[model samples]
Target: MQFKNRPNECVTTTDGREVWLSRSVATAVCILLECEGRPYILVNQRGPGMPDFAGYWNLPCGYLDYDETTAEAAMREVWEECGVNTLELLAQATCEFFSAPWDVNSTPRGARQNVTIHHGLFARVAQLPPVSNANNEPDETTDIRWLPLSDVETLTFAFNHHERIADFLAHVEKLAGISYR
Candidate 1:
């Protein structure tokens, strides 16, 4: 699947020189396991207005703000995107993807204009408290669901997120000494 909106781009500066600009965005994806020690994954409904992966099932995550640590951003985004305030990081992993710079002249308003090297940080939440979104904008997520890891294939997840989900599930399955296809 080709995403029209990418993080990298080239621009023509005032001097008529082509300038390449790249952006680094950090996101935290939460895999909230069932509190009863069962093997299940927590997912959230993405906010409708989000340009990428909106209205789909996704892990609780968002961009790491400037001056914020990855851990800080992870916990914060979890609470903001989902109604989970008591989240604790159980583990972490990262994934990155690259795209060529593209013109944003036809891009959506307020889009991140540049080539983006996005870092996805995976986190396991220890405490899953029922929470609400603090962000006033049409939040990127509106609902949350807990599903067995085996059912991940049934959810409509973003392209970049699928691999990380599989990797995390595999790690957990290995730790529990359970066989998963």
Candidate 2:
């Protein structure tokens, strides 16, 4: 059987023999909170103690638990990483499709053995309440902030998150009237 475009489900690879090997499925929510007529994106700095990609900037995102929707994962990640309860999802975007090489040595617990980087983007409109939690956070993520998308290019963030930043810059123009050519 072939796969249809399901925004929330991960599809198995084309080869029929790969059952246990599955694609890495994850999602991200880009909350564009407006302040002073400017668009600011919520960003997080990886925890210094994280084993990989530590001290790097990235969007508030995390893996989806079994039976959880992308939107749910996004909201949960935002709350866990930043302690803000978002009201609703405003818009959603999918990353450009690309085939990623399969790796045999890297194994993150609960990570899909067949890892392909597919990104889903979400936008939240309302302001979130200030609530911080120390116990409920991924070891790899630390420090959260909302910054202007135009100024984000100056920061040296992990390479994987650069595409989201580009998408974010586009959203800033569409939502906040900020243009970058």
lDDT, candidate 2, 1-181, per-residue tens: 8864334444467875434534565655566554455656677788866666788887776677889765666667777887766543333212211122111223344533422232223343354335354645456465677767677776667635667657655755664465543
Candidate 1 structure quality by residue, lDDT tens digits, 54-149: 777776656657797655665666667765542333333221111211111222335443222222222333544455666525766677766666
Consecutive 10-residue window with the lowest summed lDDT within model 1: 95-104
Candidate 1, residue 177: lDDT: 44
Our model 1 lands, by Cα RMSD against the true structure, at 9.0
The clash numbers for all candidates, in the given order, read: 12, 0
Over 4 Å off, model 1? 1-20, 86-128, 134-136, 173-181
Top candidate by lDDT: 2
* Weakest ten-residue segment in model 2 by summed lDDT: 95-104
Whole-model Cα lDDT of every candidate shown, in order: 0.52, 0.55
**Estimated TM-score per prediction?**
0.59, 0.60
